[model samples]
Target: MVADAPLRLSDTNACVDAVIERVGKNITLGLPLGLGKPVRFVNALYQRAKDDPSINLHIVTALSLLAPRGSSSLEKRFMGPFAERLYGRIPELAYARDVSANRLPDNVKVSEFFFKAGSFLNNVDQQRNYVCTNYTHAVRDLMALGVNVIGQMIAPGDGSGQVSLSSNPDLSLDLLPLMREREAEGTPVAVIGELNENLPFMGQHAAIAETSFDVLLEHQPSDYPLFSAPQMAVSPADHLIGFYASTLLRDGGTLQVGIGSLGAALVHSTIMRHKQNDDWNAVFDRLRVADRFPVATEDGGTEPFREGLYGCSEMMVDGFYYLLDAGVLTRVVYDHAGLQTLINQGDISQQVSLDTLDVLRREKLIDSPMRARDVRWLTRFGIFRDTVEFKGGRLRVGEQSLDADLDNADSREAIRTLALGDRLTGGVVMHGGFYVGPESFYQALRDLSDEDRQRICMTSVNYINHLYDHAFGTQRLKAAQRVHSRFINSAMMYTLSGAAVSDGLDDGRVVSGVGGQYNFVAMAHELPDARSILTLRSTRQSGGEAVSNIVFSYGHCTIPRHLRDIVVTEYGIADLRGQPDEQVYLRLIRIADSRFQQDLLKQAQKAGKVAPDFTLPADWCNNTPDAVRQAVTRTGDEELFPAFPFGRDFTDEELTLGKALQTLKAATSTRRGKLVTLWQALREKDEDGRYAALLQRMGLENPRGLKARLDRRLVIHGLRKLDTPSDTGSKET
Candidate 1:
């Protein structure tokens, strides 16, 4: 590649041909994990590699967002039409299709750093080829394995003649500079970028020059919409967990949240606290938040946010947007150390004006003999224009020049009035490494004004995930801005000893990679005023059975017991930090579901971790899902605890059908239930027109063959069961 090479604009096929011509056979391709992969370009490459086996292909990526294809007949009947309606006009993912069908060519190999939800559960090839690494270190590990070509999807910048990495600057921002360095040293590396108008034009480090890529592909901005994960519904159990977690949040603190139903629930509860404080307090009173969990009161605030919050997350999900719109994410932190220190000490607000300058001078935060670096810092913050120059005790802006003598009243007055203006008013409300949300989220980001867009800084994962001691001179500033930080994440299972298993199973099969959960856990302990809060449901449904998530012990642990801080379930909150083994075991059991509490206590006693005569309190026996629902339902406002608080893609009818289908699937999961369901289905009748539309929607309207008739009968019986209001025992597995 030549230095300052002109970016060649070409079609997808031409771009792939150029790449193939350059790298020839045995090409090692690198792409971002999620929404960043260029769909058309990757599809063309996959087709080319498939046609010619001589051209060996090694694809490296993770989290390929593909529409779900059901593995069973019943699942297929329900999901086929649902996915078609949900994902309109989005092109079929080629690599995902081939992998799902187990039809990859002999010369093509796919390696992933992370797997999509249950995508590799039974696939031997993908399981064996998985690469386990953290999100912040994925690029380093891939490059060490000699990944030579990189491609990604990007959005057009705002009239800057540049492009934005948009949702996936996580690894590319750190990898691009290194790729350029290698090219400069006579090593050929190809960086391909494709422009899609639907992606949001993010600011900060996500914006890059057009020349950063060797080849570029452009299509109509409306030709493709950004791929997104549909928002899941928040159950009553999820809402209760959120209610407990909300009491543990400080007013003027930093927040970190992930993408899931739990994260959505947390955002909902926080919004309620800020917008409807009386209702929130009522719910808190019913739950006994202060009485049962005194640590929440000691560390967190119950009153509404007067100072607001700032967000520092590895992935910016749509929940943050909802928080921002509700005015709960209004706290701003600056990038300069002096300003951050003042803000941390409550000496100055986010508004930067002459009053701020006066406060700085009165506090002696700045001196008269200003250093050159200080002048540059001031310029960077827009305190002075780019034309301003500092040299040997003098500052010049445009045609005006002033001495750096702070003691001189004239010089001080001139500097304060002229150099410090209202241009440096805004500060960042959030700093995120990358973002991927619903289609509405992308539209919200794209419609933001330049000023609002800058407030949500998109940068590298290193800054958001860990404290970099060698981050030039900004480490202290970063640390100061992160005071009273709370990193909230989700886990799958947690042991009585406080060890958490989030990313894998005991059999050593990978469910998901260790992506940034460990990073936040470590950082929570490393920071003085930070706490890591991990949330999980007290029980999970598996194979038609309800299993307790709080186990006696787990074989594998993603986060060790030593790093435990706070864990929340629907029942209550557990503060395990620095607690003894017996105390930790008891606390964990206290928050478990009532059905499993006795069994957990017995297991703890057997292991000698707790006393033999120990028993759970009678007051804590109300830790059931039914109790959670009744408490929220008694508020007389059903909308307060909705499935999707912000918005949803599915229609009301679709949601109803989906729920009925889920109940049916769960009913037929066991052998005895299957036989009983079959017997009931044979005697049932759908003579009424109530379920006609649903049957047509599921493609079982007119049954012809014996198999189709049997499927329809079973579906009809399941639908009747769903209509029965008394049946609440079934859960989706």
Candidate 2:
């Protein structure tokens, strides 16, 4: 009679059976992007499909995280131990593994809306099935494809009587209402959740009642370690690019950055500006940033933050954690629209007083004679103490009872004496949708107190990415919160016409899906005080040669010329928001690598975008590979711009060997370079046991076969150079 209302909570295998039974053979199950998928349930279902070819299963998702499994013998030898140390027993998603290796059966199909940034360049199957959609539009598109079942990894909660959608509330919170609507329309839709004890419990909108799920699975066998990717080294070019971008951030602004060393570099620079203002000022003055591009000085700052920033990134990378620790991300915003606006206009301080109540009363957010709802709202934000209670239109403080009329002077005095708090509560300093980072980041989050963890709200992507929807608040409130916002993202190639190439190539093969880059860029144009800053190295190595990332034109564009606001490379900054064609061309060319400026200028002249007789400026023609290196050296900050600003998981031997191997790989990328490397390796007189530890780490200490001997020789040759350049730039196909 209750229609299975006893609350069916089972294990992984039982839940998999229930899902198949409810959704039938042709199930288009939906999974959350990244670390939130139910790995055990998904693997069981995939095995069922693989074992029985009659079962048709098509799944849709994005950013499927995979642990490293090196492709070749040499790479395997290097990464095997490293992988075991990091991702110990994390269960790899069977569908992702199969789809990546082109080993899926005929009856199983998997598609993703995003890839882990250039992980699928030559993958024909993944490139073909990739669904291109903005991050905010994922739920609508997933529904259009007839997604019937959904599953997620959840924190079962620490006796809080709620389940927390930790790590990912991005897509599932947006898709749940539609799934319920379909169920009401006589369609079979299953909502399943698998419990993981490792995820940190995220409160607020991410926590929901346990009755929300149709089936809940808590199994001991499924308890595995969460995946933690190794943090890579930040290059010298990344530091300078980050420094240039840091100059553009205003005090008390908003920030949204992606996950990687580039964003960490920017965070490092921002922290430097805050903690070591003298050094930051020194670097700023030495680079002559104000002379060539006055926008950095006029529109930005070189001093420290008087009022800290608010983080509004969709992915809460570890950089935000660092900022929070350094007291740089301490600016918080409340949920009340009127109060947020007042805070933005500086009418009331975070410190609560009689003035705050007066402002709220004047704004008519609360009535003179407070109702129950009004009293509850005030107490919820800690404007009033919990000791204050409302009963029959009267206020009850700890030992005093008084009338609740704020317009009356006696009642207001009573409130100020007993009910008012010193500061506001229920304000968030950061709002993010999903998060993925190093193991240390996860541990830091898990170790936070309940009070501190709730200050970072992990909510739906709809609320975080754009202000078009009214699910959370109005666009006006968002505008007030996101003041002078900076959305810094990476780019693959930039054209002289001010277009950015980020996701794909001209041949229509996607390097990564258009996940949220377009959403943020379009949002940057919509917000009046906001700017989109695209960062890239001035040059990248291809075929053992440095090639300019700034080109005349590219076949495809991610952000069109009309949407370009700011572009930052190691050379300098280019302001391109509302400039003319000639000005955009000149500014972009001036920031290009010095070796490629003339060629780019000639191409622009051939296209008639620039004048035929235009001459390159003298001051902007010194953007060599070593320019940033030398500038950093002059400032005596080589130690500050470390290879890994954050602590690393790699061993000491591994770090040295990894860099040497990278140099060798670059040296062997071309035919001529390969010949030179081979000849040099053959004649290497590495007799002195200088590379004994490195050789033993790579498993090449004693060689037997010809291949092993060659590997040993290559290792010896790779170890000959220890002073290799630190700026191995970002690469793309």
Candidate 3:
């Protein structure tokens, strides 16, 4: 491999062959999570390992996305066309598919720090192999495993000797240092990049010289479409959860949101608060948000954003785009520590006024007579015009050179007149590690102007996930940029003791890896004004039973009781940051579903965690599913809570059918529920023309067999149930 240029290979097999020759048969491959995995090269390498049993391949990564496959026949029929149509030419990850099906070759062992949410619930292999670590420690863990080969899908630059890590620079940027160290030690190591034309070429820290890679797989076959995640329907419960969480956000603050419908809901609510304050206030008032939970009014706000928000998240979710479109995510933080600190302190504005340079001088950041280095630094940060030149203790503009000394009044005037720019450039509105979403998200990034694209920096996870960054960003800079921060994420359950269960079940089945939730939660405690918020539905349908997510105790805890902060459900918000155990129990129960509150309270009382004499308040007792539905529907505003806040990939028919299928699946999850659903389907009337389009879509219009007829009847029953209004979280048919 050349120092100035990568060993470019157009063929996938050639790249794999080069890697094998360099790293021998025993290869420890480290691929980036999600969309950045170099599919072609990895497939070829894995194939080689399979064919030659002597080769041992250990692949380590997270969220290796495979196209969705439905288990039942009807689900397959519904999802088949949708998946094929959306992800037709996209290269499927053969490793993920094999690993999922438990058919991995004995020689190839795969490990992941994070699984796609709920992907491997019953797989003992995945559960046993799951690496428990934060997102910040992924690089460290990979190095400890002696990873020698790194693979990624890169975006091409403008014919320069550069490329953007594009969707994922997360671990690759962090691992570069270690890879370099191995190379210096003469240890065989490889960095392979497969170029994709569809990948959005993001700049900032994501851009690096092509020499970073030792092997390049660049051609048509390898440059397939990137894997995309379609938008899921945001339930009424999710919207309510988002609405409650939105009130906890300060106007001028920092935000860290995860990827999913819940995060999207929060962004939508925030947008509504900013754009349609009247509608937002109506919902807030109707829900008695201020009256019940004064923490919202005391710590958070309900008014429009005057200072806006700066997004500092691990994943650059599509919701940020909606917020950006609404002019709500406009708070930009600079790269320089002093400049960002001044902006945060209100000592200087982004507009390149004379105060910008004056503040820098006052902070002892620059000399009275600016040195050549100071001139370069000012121009680099957009404080000065590029046309202004500093040489020999003077400021040069075209032909005229004036005194550069700020102490001289005449020189100051001359410098301000010639060197000032309109506003600050190089300030980033969002700092993210990686992203995966619907086609619109990728297209949105592709369609952005170069100037606009730079506003959302796709950098290493070390930068956005925590404030302990020594490379990409410093603790001081992150602290200064983040003010009154709200770190929002989703959890599956919460205990009365204030512990949060997010990643896995008590049975030792891995649902998803603890990627950055722990990092943000710990950081929230460290930051003076920041709060970590975990959101979940109050009640969820599990095995056809309405189970309470707020439990008395849980075996697995992602966020322990000591680190508990804010938790939001459809009913209300529970601030458990500094509260006692009994107070935590009371607050959690008040926000739980009305049906389960009694049992939860009884359990708490029996365990001596809460007062047995304490009875539920009448106002809090109405925290039911119907109450949440009535609250949203009574507003008479459709735009207040939408299923798809940003644009959706699903069509109207698909949306209708998908929702009905979900209700059917939830209703019939257990034997008793299935029997009841079967009885309902047998009595369902099919003479109506209302479901003609839906029947045609599901291929149940003209059934030729008994199974087909039964499926048709089930479809009709589901469609009929869809017309009836129920709680968003209710799975009952």
Candidate 4:
């Protein structure tokens, strides 16, 4: 009798064991880290290695272990008062702050940090939870480090005795080389996930087979925690910043946004502009900026935005969701299944349109009598306003509307208004490989009808890298064109004079894998109508000092100066792409936090990148710490402005700890020995609990000083900030 099938699907734990066994002597092991099997499985392996003395395990995933080398919004949230409470109770331990600094423990080490270099440093690690970039590099590095075991998921039946590293493809085509080498060396043991059965089959290298992996894990698709970006209070500071960027966005401009706090803030601000019927677009027209939005291109379609704007980009994050609600992403012209199908697929690919208004009306940008039922149902998905009305086959709402029957002149003007209104509402594509946090927002989106849900894309299954590319691409090209501009408030957008951007530097080491920035930036330059904007704080605290992020040079640049398009701070915008050395230096100097502007200018002058006669703009020079504080203040109290504009996903204690941590950091930076004294004064019981809490904030990690050390090193490189000895001995450390 024929033997039973040799390749039965393995149970989750059995799959994990088989992969681990296959990894028996592989030198490197890489997997995505987050809430899913990717993270759980990888962590399990690490724990196993911790127990097995023979196993020399090294992980290349993006976890708290690989956080940036400086204060992160996430870290600050955890380290603040939590540190104070724990260290306060044990004053003697406060001096141990440096114990967690740069030097890795003898047992664990990440030898090489890999990442795609780009302007925004867009990558998997920076987003809520991205497995592709994180997993790819981690695996690659493990092999390079002479790691004996490398474990990752693949489709069953895709393996040919040899394992295949397959899934969604990243912008970095070079990963194929690493895979080939691994397979050629007979080192790769593919661990496949059968979760793709229900996923849409994307085209190209994204396709994979069950046979490619050496071991197949037949468990149900991981149940990812649905995280929602908070609906933040849109402060005037955020509004003005978003407004300025919006002005740069022409009706058809393409865009790319990073993820996180500022991203949500920007989206909220944009939605407000739509609600208030702002005249922001007029500003862009008046400026006569380069790469103006195209009403119609060779693609032979008039962008509805010819009357206004549209957006296209990769992040299917909150920004994308907001765009859909506001109505900026209406489909004027579509190829296969029309707008609805494209929306459901969670993507759009097209060029500008000439007669966009007429075409869109014919195609249903306005409600047709035939589709009135669908339109009414749209309201359930939060797609329509209470004021929506149909007159002569056109959609009318509030003061503005879209009418197909108006004369050429009336239609032109009406179309502009309609486009603007829609631009305000639509153009967001949200996707995350792993989402962790509050699920309300996601549930809100998922609650929408298939057509409305089609407007949002949740990339549940794909390769670690390709998912990012799809997310980033959709964000830049699709979301930007529809929405005017987009925002990414995630992390680490390094600016070199040209051609590179790096993320996370610590004592000459890279902490995480290169994610999607390279793809986003390259795509940005290609999209004349679009821009890739990078956001970063002005400074970070290390040891007991504040370090400036606007440095003359980074020891390693995640995104080079050439690729540097636009960098923003609380101060202002620094447009650096395609600029001369002098221009770049001058522009960057203008936006550096006020306290360091003069120093930066001096350094620029010393380097001869700026002329001695180059004077700071009077308006730009007005920026000061107090001025920034005032800038963010609105009609309410200062404390009302949340560090995260949307909403805080953390607990009340966590928020308090974040605030306290910010205060402590400020104290540590300004006063020598204060970090230690502060630690002593604030230390409390449950020190381990505090550490654990911080770790959970970082997605459930054990307390370790590696991330903290990297932060300090980056501070030293970026702003020359260093920790004082006494501060290094903090009890929390």
User: CA lDDT of each candidate?
Assistant: 0.82, 0.85, 0.88, 0.43
Residue-wise C-alpha lDDT for candidate 2, range 559-605, written one tens digit per residue: 88888889999899999989999999999999899999999999999
Q: What is the lDDT of residue 642 in candidate 1?
A: 88
User: In the order shown, what is each candidate's alpha-carbon RMSD?
Assistant: 2.5, 2.4, 2.0, 13.6
**Pairs clashing within candidate 2:** none
Model 3: pairs clashing at backbone N, Cα or C within 3 Å:
none
Per-residue CA lDDT of model 3 for 1-733, tens digit only, reads 3367888888888998899888899899999989899898999999888899999999999999988879886788788878888888887888889998999999999999999988888787888888999999999999999999999999988888899998898888889878889878888898998888899999988999998988878895547877889988787888899999999999889999999889988988999999999999999998889988999998899989988999998898988888887899989988877788888888988778877778899999888788999888888888888888888888888897988788888887887888878888888889889999888888988999877788988888988887887886688888888889999999999999999999989987889989999999999999879999999988877786789999989999999889998999999999988898899999999999999999999999999988879899888888877777767678887656777778788888888888788878988999988999999999876785889988888888898899888888898888888887663445421
State how far residue 266 of model 2 sits from its true place (Å).
Answer: 0.6
Best-to-worst order by lDDT is: 3, 2, 1, 4
> 469, model 3: CA deviation in Å?
2.2
Per-residue accuracy of model 4 over 586-627 as CA lDDT, tens digit each: 777776767777888887788787888877777667655556
Error of 1 at 321 (Å): 0.8
1-733: candidate 1 lDDT, tens digit per residue: 6337545665788888878766667678889878899998888888989989888888999888887768667678877876887676788779878887788898888999888756788888888889988887887887886777889998876666689988888888888877777777776778888888888888777888888888888777435877878888888888888878888889999999988889999999999999999988888887778898998898887788889999999989898988888999988878777788887887766545656656766776655566677677667776655667787678887778888666677977887766665556447899888777888888888788877888898888877887873432356777887888899999999999999999889998888778899999888888878889999999987877789999998899999999998999988899998899999999999999999999999999999999998778898787887787786678768888888887887776567677876776677779987788778889877898678887887688898898888878777777787777677453421
Q: Which one wins by lDDT: 1 or 2?
A: 2
